[model samples]
Target: MAETGLIQSRYRLIELIGRGGMGEVWRALDESLGRQVAVKRLKPVGPQHDRTFTRVLRERFRREARVAASLQHRGVTVVHDFGEDEGVPYLVMELLDGQNLSQLLEENEQHPLPVEHVVDIAEQVADALGYTHRQGIVHRDLKPANIMRLTDGTVKICDFGIARLGHDIGMSSRLTTTGLAMGTPHYMSPEQISGKEVDHRSDLYSLGCVLYEIATGAPPFDQEDAWAVLVGHRDTPPEPLRTHRAELPGFFDRVVLDLLAKAPDERPADAGDLRRRIVLGRTGEQPALGPGPLARPATGLPPAPRAKALPAWTRSMTAGRPATGSTPPPAGRPDPAAGLTGQWTAATATAPRTGSSVPAGPPAPDLLATLEGRHGAGIDLGRLGRWAEAAEVHREVAAERLRLLGPDHPDTLATRYEVAYTLGRLGRWAEALEIYQDVARARAAVLGADHPDTFVARYEAGISLGRLGRDTEALEVYRSLVEDRTRTAGEADPETLRARHGLGVSLGRLGRWEEALAEAREVCALREHTLGPDHPDTVISRREVAAGLGWLGRWREALVAYRQVAEARTRTLGPGHPQTLAAREDEAHCLERLAQA
Candidate 1:
């Protein structure tokens, strides 16, 4: 350790900053750039003659360098350089002058954060996390020690990609079983503890744990031993954030608790949604949250990177490969949303954004978003039912846009709604429901309940709920959505037409076949008027009308309507497409019912 003064004839090591299982951090200088840097000198491994340790450690170090160097975000600490300085592996990063969350907690034990402050920090971390998760990377080890609160009040995440590399290379042997293989028990996700194939949701759970601690200065699941903590994570729910800070908004508690859901299916669909809710809670007229000062963006910090602009592994901690079973199988190898794409959105310039003439020029710094909000525009090659690819792409773009542009900004929430619709088609109903709910809340928060986007997300949410088998619940949601859409989307708009169909399905599920038939006929008539009788959606809606008529015991009318749908679909989409085949099947069934009648 004595010989670790400086390296590269630059980055002069001034003093030891901190130490962890892997190594010690040193305040250093970048002689080339005349900037301050933090260098982590990893603890060395076994005997040089031990080829096994040496070979493994070297590979791990290289992978870490690649991962850290690749990560460039305002919330993430920047890795300037990494090299073997005289046989000791060293990684140089931006020197953030700040105290860690651990230190802050130690100073103020059990003292709850101001609601606004807790939300601000959570929003920033969620944004960075969303980006990292999308890159297919999970922190695997998120805790207070890894998060630093900069002098200017900004939170900077550190040692992101290094935990895996550092643990594998040599740190595990030194720290014992309590260190490398398992994470800080208080923050470990259940899947991570069980060593199951984890996903981005695992990271969200871990982050929720972190937020739990920050909100109340106590770990969500506290037990005497690491094993107990693991069990608590698997079984227990954290005390609601409001319990600790009763002044906290009820919505904030719901958001945090949702993140801590035992199953990922129950959590908010992604980190982007988390951020949106935070924004609304903090800034809304009747803020679901409290009075926290809005964050200033021009502070000294690097700009966020454009989301979906990085290499795959940048967010691939959970990706494991180009495929995740979370969504249906995609079409090709390079999926845009393959990684931790929807973890957090990149922060746009968040300065007082009320005036119609928005601020121009380069965006302000110190914002916590990872994506720069540049959405990709390109045509994908056709693939056989590659619904996953389209769904993922729309989800990624929509999440980023919402975070970058806000709910009513036209692009962000709008794009997200498209992704939800795609998820329904791709069979990811649970996730789609979550996404649609988020969009709905954001729309209701920003634009009021009657806004078009509000109805859009609510309508989609009702559709997802219907597919998920909570039909009675779906009926209520769809009924409200149908009314809302009729008023906002108008009877002829495609979305309104779609919701009308949802209403009929919900009614059938509730055994109100007469009402179902009437609504279906109305939607079909409206669609036919607006889209021409032969249009695909119109023909599909018409088929639904026939199905409703059959349910209502009007078999002869059902057969007639079904025949028209089958012919129209067979003409436009040929005989093999799913919709076309479905229409034909419906027509045949209706004919049989008619003969019986």
Candidate 2:
């Protein structure tokens, strides 16, 4: 729209990328940033005179841009800037050097992408969407054209032009006010085509449609007419991928089907977790278990060429880097221990049982990581939760500590402790227990078993055991943990209180009501003193005391405890929430029990 072969000579509008129903993508040089970026522009600013139509069109683009920019994840497209150029609003995003899956499929119609590659891309896309959903955002449209695959093979999701956000856009959707259908018919979830309020799981359903295409080279439901496609998505059963790609991983095929379910609840609860599962499905060649940096070279694929030169101002913004660089820096602080080892005096000697001591030997955790090295974007592709990502990140940190400080370094063990704790968060109880036990043993050997770090790992091991559903085993673990933590951390410490709370939980699970109640009360009081009355953990301990009271047939006291939990959760977490609702429900149950008693 501008005379300078550019829009304001700031965005040198280069060649077009591809045109979609809502917008046209251009491979533009961001003269402001001195880097190449993709500019997605809406189709001719759609009928602005009719306020309602203008509102919907503008609002749609605006909301999508805002929400997309708000989210910062390596798997998601990086939105750099947004503004109006010559009467047309546009979005500036990281100029990814690769083809959209749509283009790849188009280029190779008969041969689908390799299953391993497909899984890798799918995991990244799902993880990105999963993170967005958790933040209360939903990608109303998820399709092949929106997913970008770099030559290095990392997937970046783009085009949130129609994404619905929890925040209010300048323009609101009356069509959406009535809740109308708005996604690609073939990729649309059944509930979405029917005009229902959507959430994160809806994105998962769309992901199923996309994954189905990746696996079989066709959308799950494709028809000659758009209407038929919509209807088919509503009623048709997707053909199983294994029917065509018999070599596909059976578990992954099941996971794809699980995402395609009609109801949101029927799909996986989180995209991050879905991504992790897909990641774990990869062959040995792919690194799917850890912290993911997003710097992979394009797979010998030529990037779409830029038509116009970036302006002098924009060139300055590039920080003098060449226009062709595609490596987006990895998220958070770069883990210093990317590829190195231990500095401790001895290779495997344990530190004393002293609390929090840096052993005289090499840092055991980093030493272990060095022994079993990890790399890549640290994208946690092999599990079903954010815990995978967290665990990997902590492991990476541990590795760096090992490399920088040496094996027996105190900082190294501290990082390893985090790794063990993070593993528990990911719901991998057996593995987490193993790691926790290892760290505890190491801490006890080097720092002394009575050290706070050793006791911490011991307590975590008990929690992990409980998560694994081994109540008797968990009970025994917790009993031991409580004793050790009490002696090492002291009864007044919050961690010691937490150990007591775990003991109470394990006791209750083992049907030892009296002991559970006694331990829980002690935990509640200690936590209140050490961590403050308002701390959520303290409140939870108090709630456990009530549950234990119920187990002992003390309904009145149980009701009191349940009421406190309900009120606290409502205040802290919010009402009508899944957790809050469950708490209130528990309160109701306790009240009913008291009435009966």
TM-score of each: 0.45, 0.45
Candidate 1 local lDDT, residue 434: 94
For model 2, the run of ten residues with the poorest summed lDDT: 313-322
Of the candidates shown, which would achieve the greatest lDDT relative to the real structure? Answer: 2
| Residue 339, model 1, lDDT | 28
Error of 1 at 449 (Å): 63
Residues 1-597, candidate 2, lDDT per residue (tens digit)?
642268756888778876654467888887877888788876554331233234445665787788888999888888888877766778888888988888899989746788878878887788777777777787767889888899997888887866766553311221110011245667776555543445666788888988889888888876654434653554345678899889988778877987876545546657876776666656423323233221221323211111111111011111111011122223432222332333233332344334433345544565555433332223232222243454556677677765545544444665676566544443345776787788778666655555554565676677666556577987787678667656655788655565666667667656787987888788788878888776777776776677667667786777667667656766877653333444444544453343345
**How far off is model 1, as Cα RMSD?**
24.7
Candidate 2, TM-score vs. the true structure? 0.45
Q: What CA root-mean-square deviation does each model show from the true structure?
A: 24.7, 21.1
Per-residue lDDT of model 1, residues 245-294, tens digit only: 78877767777776776555456667776777777767752324332212
Stretches of candidate 2 above 4 Å error? 20-22, 43-49, 167-181, 283-597
Tell me how many residue pairs clash in candidate 1. 25
